[model samples]
Target: MDPTAVGRSGAVILRPMRVDDVAEAERLSALAFAVLEGNSDLTRPPERAAAWQVRTAHLVSRDGAGCWVADADGTMVGFATSLRREGLWILATYAVHPSWQARGIGRALLDAAAHHGRGALRRMVGATTDPKALRRYRSAGLDLHPTMVLEGTVGATAMELPLHVRDGRPSDHEWMDSLDRGLRGAGRGEDHTLLSALHPLRVIDRPHRRGYAYLAPDSTVELLAASDRRTATDLLTDALSGAVGADVRQAHVTAANQWAIDVGMAAGLSLRAQGYLCLAGMKPPSPYLHHRALL
Candidate 1:
């Protein structure tokens, strides 16, 4: 099924996905991800497509799992995926086939995602640094919230640190809680999604646990090193180590604290990309979560 052919008027249809759509979805995914200019920077497009297809297939396979697809003549043109959490839904991905562009297909996908969160007062979305998507998100009633972001292929040291330690377990909620507090002190709001707190459960390296510096379930990588001079490097090592089993062509870091920048530098993670924090509603409070973990 083509992700671009979704949402035709009378003959076309947009509805939840089904089991049979996996192969076409994977195909569309490969075609889509293949457009990246830096496909070889880290992970390749096929790997990401496979992983996304697995996740989407899982969503379509489960009961109460919500995934909306725009189908035209039995072809999947566009699709949106979400996960329900604490009675609210978090959008995972919303995409329309490249061939189906400028036809409101993306909007249809977003609307479907919003529809999945019915009765919930608020919804959260995370967008990457893709400028085109950023514009579309803003037009879709998403507000660009400021955040502490660090990205660049350009290499530079933000700060230096001098502490090293092994990764902490996900079950170590106490330490995580403390780290959260420290992060909050550095100016982060209370937008804690599972992705933000993705730590502990993630295993590092297929052969052993030493492959990743920080391992967590969702996305957060608690620092393994902290110092005035080399904190950024330690954090980068932790993040790269933690990114196993996932396709990451590049790394984007967002942090409000000195430690975040410092560790990023030490790890040699570049400051290559930039983006705005997208908020769903009017301004709320100070110290909002950084952009990288907004979801």
Candidate 2:
């Protein structure tokens, strides 16, 4: 159990998803994402409530998704979702009922999830156009990596953590909300452009497809050649040799990923210079890569 998750009045409860909690989760997301503190563009369509429903359905499905709800005085006020991929666990979505914003509910929920996810040295990400979310993440010991927007090409900072899969799934949902939060919060992506980019690739041949199973349009190619500049250049040259007319002109690679960076350079993929942040409980075995190879 999460010790930090006491209610505002010191009686709040942190618990797993319940049969009847779906509606409340939707309601909280509507209130929170709709009138988010800083981002106003999200209020323009479908109502935040409608968007919440769609996101909730994605998070609770049996495809390695996890969720948690917070109740204050028996009222559902906040919810969080975590999505799992091969070696990565990302916080996909989270919404706090408007009535319960500044309280410790969010932190408590995060703590509980993190506690449960012990020994994984997790890399979690969060996105928020809302100033409040940015503040909350910072307060909760998350540092800013790179601030990116998914506009013409997918551009965003990548974070990493080493996690051991249990029963072929990640241990928790605490980090799941970050990816969706970043995308929706960034809000620069359009369905048409994404579909157009992803439509032509019938076969995506890339090495590392872990952590990014949710990529929709383009296939992210992940393989490390060598740490040296020459190796980086050669690896990319080889990868793109077979990529003629495969429907991708752009890609993302973690700055720390030496081979991918070399590939990006040789292929004319300009690094949209931004503040990229990195965290590790211990040194990584090799340079970790975060690529925007797919949606």
What candidate 2 gets wrong by more than 4 Å, as runs, is 1-11, 37-66, 83-88, 129-131, 150-202, 206-295
| Runs of candidate 1 exceeding 4 Å displacement | 1-11, 36-46, 61-65, 129-132, 145-252, 255-258, 275-277, 281-294
Report lDDT (Cα) of residue 103, candidate 2: 75
Candidate 1 lDDT, 126-188, residue by residue in tens: 665556667777776777653344433323333233244344453443343333334322211
Q: Could you tell me the TM-score of candidate 1?
A: 0.60
Best by TM-score: 1
Model 1 per-residue lDDT at 88: 37
Q: What's the TM-score of each model vs. the native?
A: 0.60, 0.49
Instruction: State model 1's lDDT.
Output: 0.47
